[model samples]
Target: MNRETLVLPVLAGLLTSALAGCGGSDDSGPGGGTIVVGTTDRIEATADAPAPLDPAQAYDTASWAVMHNAFQTLMRLPRAGSQPVPDAAESCGFQDNHSEQYRCTLRRGLTFADGRELTSRDVKFSLDRVRRIAHRGGPATLLSSIDKVETPNEREVVIHLSAPDATFPSKLTTPAAAILDSHDYDPKALRKGFEVAGSGPYTVRTEVDGDRLTKAVFTRNDAYRGELEPRSDTVEMRFFDDSAALERALADGEVDVANREFSAEQIDKLEAGRVAGVRVTESPGQAIRYLAFNTKAPAVREKAVRQAIARLVDRQALVRDVYKRTGDPLYSLVPTGIAAHTNSFHNTYGEPSVAGARDVLRDAGVRTPVKLTLTYTTDHYGPATAKEFTALRDQLNASGLFTARTQGVRWTRFRQDAADGEYAVYGMGWFLDFPDPDNYIAPFIGKDNFLNSPYRNRAIEDDLLPRTRQKAQRALAAPEFRRIQDLVAEDVPVLPLWQQKQYVVAREDITGTEYALDSSAMLQLWELGRGAEG
Candidate 1:
C-alpha cells in the first residue's frame, strides 16, 4: 500500500476534529479550574542550572515531567503499556528486513501550538539537532545509532541507522525525540529561556520562575493531535524545596496531586490516614538508585578496592533503614521484573562482611584505613539521601577497611560536576525512558553512557549489544542480557543499591491515580482529574 493511503485512515482514527467541542466538562474549560500538582524537583534556567523545557537539551526526570506533556513525539507510550503507538505519526516501522532503515509517515495537518506546520522535515531537524549540539550529560546519547535522517516528503521520514537496531523506534518515544518546528527552534544550539513551541497535549501559558520555579501554568493545546485527551483543561505545576513542604501543600488542599521525592515517613503517614482526605497509590517502579565509581580516580582504580567496597554495602539494611523498605534491594543494573534480571551482586559479594572486605584489601596489598570521599546532592534526591549516604559511610568505617568522608552539593552543581568527574564516588538514579532491558543496559554501558564516569566494556558494548539488538523478540535475547549483568557485577563500575516503589498522593476527590503513571514511571498530568468536589 502507498504511504498516503495507509496513513490517512489511521490519522482519521487517531485525532479528534479540531473544531469539535472540547471533550471534558464545560467547567474544565481552558485555564478554568486548575489541577495543582506538587513535586520536590526544581525547574530553573541559568548558567549553572538550566531549565528542562527545551527537548533537545533536557534529559533528567524533573524536566521530563513537563516536557512529556508539552511536547509530542512521533510515537507515545499508551496510558498503560510499555509499548509505544503512533502519536504524531500515522504509521511507523522498519523499511527493510534487516531493520537498518526505519521510517514513519506523519499524520495530515499537524501543527505546532503557534499554528506553524509540523512536517517530516521538522522531525528530521529535531533528531539531527540533538546529534549536532550533543550537550554533555544530555539525551543525545540516546540517538547514537542513527547515521542520518532522510525526509522523503512533507509526511514521510526515513532514519538510516549505522547498524541494525530494533530499539531505535523505542528511542523515538523518548522526550529526546520530541518533534519541534524548524521555524521556532534554532538548528544549531539549544533555545534559551522557558518559551517552547510544541505540538503536545498542552502548551505553556505562563511560568513563575526563579532559581526554583514557584508555579508553571499549562493550558490545553487545541492543536494537539494525539490519543491522550486531557481530563482537566489546565494544569498548575508547583515546585517544593523538600517533601515536608509538599506534604504540607497536600494537607492544606493547595495541591491536587503530589509526586517525586517523598520520604518513607511521609508515605507511612499518608497510608496510615494521617492525611484525612488524601489517598496514596503505589506501584513497582523501574527506577534504580546506585553508587557510581570513577575508575580513573587513584583511590578506586584497583579492581580489588572497588569490589571490597561493594562487599561492604548492606542492601537490606540500607533499604530498611533509609528507604523504610519502600523499595527493594537491587543487585544488578537491570531492576527486577525486567527481562534477564539476575542478582549478580549478591552472587558475587554474598553478604556484607567486614572480614571479607579486609581480606580483599589486605590481599591486594592496599593499606588499611583508605581515605575515600563520597558525594551526593542534598536538594535533588530528597531528604532520605543524607541518611542513606551516612549509613553507607558508617558501613565502610565500621568495616575497618576504609575511612570515608561524605560531601553534599546542590543538584544543579552536582549534575555538572558529576559529569565532569569531580567526585571519586557519588550516588545516582535512573528512571527509564522506555521499559526495555536494552533501555536499562545500553545507556549505562555505551561508549558515551549516562554515567559520565569513564567505563568501557567492549564485550557488552560492541559485541553483546549489537547481537541482542538483532533479535526481533526481546525475550529471546535474555542470555545476552544475563551475560551483560554478570560483566557489570564483575567490573563494579556502578553498584546497584535499590529499586524504588513508585508512589503518588492525591486528594480523595482526585481520580485516575492508576492511570497517572506511565510505563516509564513518569506521572501523566493529563490523566489526573478532580471530581465534583474539585
Candidate 2:
C-alpha cells in the first residue's frame, strides 16, 4: 500500500547489486525439457508494417521480453537490481566525472545465431538504426541523450552524449539498444517479416497469425558467447487475448508459467493458495498507468479541457472498486517512492469536485457539454479496463460540463490508432524503460512521444532535464524535478492513474523463479528450468 515497498533505494541499490553476485545462479548445465509460458501481452503487427521482431521497432513489454532474451546488449540489469552491468561488453563505464561519455569493450569470439561474428560495428549500427528509422511509436525516444556513436576498433565502442546523463547506461539495456547483426538488418527502415537473428543466450523462431505474434519458440543458442549461461534448452512463449484464457492455460497444464496480465480476482486467489501447485514471485512494482492526450486532437487540445477532466476523476473509487485495490492511486507521473515525486495533481485538485471542473470550463469561455471521446484497449492491461472506462465516463458526465463516450479496441489496432492521433483522449500504461524519474516524465511529454502526441515543453525538454542529468547524485535534481512535475500539472498532457505490483506465477517444480526478473521488468528466461523435485 506504500511506495517504499514498491521501489528500491536508489544509490544503495546500485552499490549492492554491483558488488553482490549472490542473487543469480550459475546453472550452465544442459536441459532436455521444454518450458511453456503464457501471457495476455501480444506483439502487434500490421499489413503495412510487418516488422515484429526487429528491435528498433519494439517498444512494448511483450516485444521487450522476447527481444531481450534473444538479443544481447552492451549493458544489462543485474538479477536483483536496476543498475547496469556488462553483458556483451567485457568492461563498460563512463569516462568522465560528469557522466558525459561512455565506452564499452566487446567480449572476444562472440557470434550470432547463424555463426556470424559480433563486433563493435554491430553495436554502433544497432543504435544508429534506432535513430535513422525512427518509427512512430518506437523506442527511439530513449536515445535522446546520445549525440553520436563511435567505434575506435573492431572491439571497442565509444559514445558521446549531447548532455551529461548518469541514467544513459540504464537506457542501453532496453530493447532499443539491442546489439544487432549489421549485415542482417536494414539501415533505413524496419526490417520486414517475423524472422530475426541475434547473439544472446537464446535464438527465437517466431509464429505469426495475421498481425499477431501468436507464439515464439526460443532455443538455447549453442553459438552464443555472453555473460549468461543458459539453464534451459528451449522456451515456448504463448500469447492470449485476455487473463481468463491465461488462467485456464496455467490450470490445464498448457503453460508451465503464467507471466502477466492476471485479473485482480485471479491474483487474489493465487495469493490465498486457492490455485494449487503454483509458486508466486513478486517484484517491487514500478510500473504506472495513466491517460495520455493527443494534443493535436480537437477539444482535447485545449488545456482547460484536459485540466477539467483531471479535476473530475476519482482515483480512489477507481482503485478500490474497479481494480479491487490491487494498485495504489497515483497522482504524479513520477510514481510515489521514485525520487523527485510529488502529488502535484492531488494538490491542485483536492477531492473530485464538479464545481471545480465547471468553473475552469466557464472561465476559459469553453461551451458547456464539451464532447469527448475516451479510448482504451480491450486486451492490453487487464479485464478491469471496461469498468475503469465506464467509471471515468460516469464521473465526467456527473460534472455536467462534458459529454464523454468510450470506445474499446484490441491492442493491435488501438496502438496504431493512438499513434495516428485518431483518438481525442486514450488510456495507456508505461512499464519502466529504466528505474529513473526521468523515464517517467521525459517519455510522455516530448514532441515525438511514442504515442505520437504533439505535447512539447521546451523548459522540460531543454532546461530541466539537462540540469538534472548534470548531477551525479540523483536526489540533488529534486528542485528541477519538482519544477518539471509542476509544469506537467499545469499543462495537463497526461493524467496519472495508479501504480501496481508485478507478479510471475510458475509451477512448484520450477527452479529459479525468485531470480527470474530484473529491476527493469524484463523476464530473464535463461534463469528458468525444471527443478529436481519435478
TM-scores vs. true structure, each candidate: 0.93, 0.91
How high is the lDDT of residue 463 in model 2? 91
TM-score of 1: 0.93
In order, the Cα lDDT scores of the candidates are: 0.76, 0.77
Worst 10 residues of 2 by lDDT: 1-10
Q: In model 1, what is the error at residue 26, expressed in angstroms?
A: 11
Q: TM-score of the candidate numbered 2?
A: 0.91
Q: Which residue pairs of candidate 1 clash?
A: none
Question: In terms of lDDT, which candidate is strongest?
Answer: 2
Model 1 worst lDDT run, 10 consecutive residues: 1-10
RMSD of each: 6.9, 5.4
Cα-based lDDT at residue 310, candidate 2: 92
